[model samples]
Target: MDSLPNLLWLRSFEAASRLGSFTAAGVELGLTQAAVSGHISALETRLGHALFHRTTRKVDLTESGRAYLPAVRKALQDLAKSTENLFGGKISGAVTLRAPISVATLVIAPALAAFLESQPELNIRLLSAIWADTALETNIDFEIRLGAGQWPGCQAEKLGDDFVVPVCSPFLAKGLKTPADLLKLPRAHILGFDDHWPRFFETLALPVHSPTPSVTVDTSIAALEWVSSGGGAALLLERAARPLAASGRIAIPFKEKIPLGQGHYLIHRQNAPPSRPAVRVTENWLRELFGS
Candidate 1:
């Protein structure tokens, strides 16, 4: 005879032993009372000992059943927790997310520390890149981009709208009075991008002229850093610049803002489901934070 009992049989035996009645165990376990009694009898026969003292008035555990109860209960508890950890809503794994430099710095990075604390078993790899190209790197679990909700071979959900205004150091804004005055100062424009400066001038109903930049940078975060170091005025996103401006890191020199009409979006592969729990949690958190 096998030394160990079947898992289901053991479960039935444990239930019957704890409840002190095969009928009560059957009700709890969704089994017939006869089935519960059979399981307990099989377990008792395998162990070569009677686990229960049958009685018409009330059933009771024999000394052997009492001794075996704690170990079986603990085993069942461990199995339940292990099953939950494997297949339940609680997740443990790494998620790779990619986004623009400024969004990574101003938006995601600020809230990430707390998020990691809450999900101790989860780890993340955040990459900073321009969202201009729709073709993201392979193996990227998630992405944040600025565009209409139409990326070929991917899924896109609109996060929210973004706008920009001219910002500079306090010293740079000291003598600046109006939008016209901003034109004469050496402006900092993002290289390979004409959206902010041209749209800004067009919003003011002025002729779009390419003004020479004191410094041309590749990313918005770099441009903001330059402006903070007294480089020159830069057109920066309103959401990203607000906190810095409030902290005196950078000052918005103009009251006018140029709206792009294009919204930010969360991106992932088309028809690809998020298999990892961490990915689902992070995606939900981002949607909550950035959704209008």
Candidate 2:
């Protein structure tokens, strides 16, 4: 096409098509019904085809309108997204990253400050999920999840290895000498993970005959709390247990760390709605800090 239709005209066409009336489109666009009709008429003159079929009670999309609506809608969407990405409200940036509680609290929380310091304009929001291994969430800017680094409509990068290691209070930890010693204690199963205790036993060739849990909890944080009270031994992610072990609140009685096979992945849903530069900077910081 040599000449493009005016945006106001295209807007009128799209609004009228969507709402099924020029009067309603005019109401929406703050124009009179005649103005909406005039826009469509001018557009029809330019395009050499009528976009709407009109009657006394209603208006309907013509065959040409049906064909053209999708492109026009997509073009409008692209323009809006481009405007938001390039020049929208990011003077003082805001980014929301969602991750598992253990990873968020233990792994990233300690190091997140330095990242913010480096990029002084950002306000970072960390949303904690107990079961963070599932699907991509809408409106989440970044995700740190424990999984196989795969999801639809996303970019998943390997953050690092995660291993399941048994942890308990210092007093209880001192009493254990062998893998067999663990079998006698009550086991607090972290519910979201694989059957870690059974796998942990089998990894050491210590047979478990119908292994049962003393307690079950959804989050590693809860399991850690239970173990710290000397309630039972809980198998926890190595990253989750690392800080507490350093503080002497919990102890890793055995040297063996069972590979989880899956691990924490830094995931970004690529351009579903494109991210701003600050969020992109935070994404890079997370990858650099956590990625293997």
Candidate 3:
């Protein structure tokens, strides 16, 4: 017998040892039970030792098999990962992306057509959250965030500055000529948790205390819809509200704009390698959209 055992035989033995049955290993490997049993027997004979104690009902690994299990399992895992990496797994396979709901709806959704056109082979899965709630170590490939430039232990790229301004329907814009005129109208506030309206009011010189809004919403998109429906005036990001603004659904209430404190950014774990398809799609599309 040759000193070196067959790789296929070792694979069969490892699967049988972990599953505790040749029949189960056969199911997993897509082989017949007899084939699996023969492979394990061949491995044991080549090594001059019995790897498992087989009975009519079940199989148990011998002491030598137990000692060898960990190394074999780790080797197999490493080989599998390497094979996937070699076969464009990181680029063509599933890519999970996380982003804020507003950004995902307005920015990413509009730009996705171009991305899909360029890289048809890649599959993208998008996850939207109200806040930065995604666990980066999980299956997520990347995260797009709206914040000041400071994400620790991650590779960050600033997308664009998020600017906010008061937006109202054309019907509501009729009497709203000055900043003081805003006090007479009902204002829509996004309530669950964002400082957009508060920060916007701070930019004006007038002593305008935030009114207990007539309509309170949980999302920027919802607030935009309310404004479009002629419910009330809402303060929304210029980028997110641009589409509606262009369509004449909503109008900017004031000539002066307010800074919303931060910009949109794309982030990924520093230790993790970036997915090639994700990087290519994001960079090219955002550059075209934002002219950055």
Q: Which of 1 and 3 is the better model by lDDT? A: 1
Per-prediction TM-score? 0.63, 0.65, 0.61
Q: For model 2, which pairs clash?
A: none
Q: List model 3 lDDT by residue over 1-292, tens digit each.
A: 5665787887787778767889988997889999999998888877788889989988999998988777777676676656655775434556678888877887678778778776776677878988784346557777887777577777778877667778889888887888667767778877544645545555675655654788887778888788888887888877767777777889886876776777777787754532455555555566466533
lDDT of 1 by residue, 29-125 (tens): 8999999888888888888998889998557888998888778877876776567578786677889998877789887887788888988888889
Q: Rate the local accuracy (lDDT) of all candidates.
A: 0.78, 0.81, 0.74
Clashes per model (N, Cα, C within 3 A): 0, 0, 0
Best-fitting candidate, measured by TM-score?
Answer: 2
Better of 2 and 3 by TM-score: 2
Query: What is the descending lDDT order?
Result: 2, 1, 3
Worst 10 residues of 1 by lDDT: 269-278
RMSD of each: 16.4, 7.0, 9.3
Looking at candidate 2, the ten consecutive residues that score lowest on lDDT are 269-278
| TM-score of predicted structure 2 | 0.65
Best by lDDT: 2
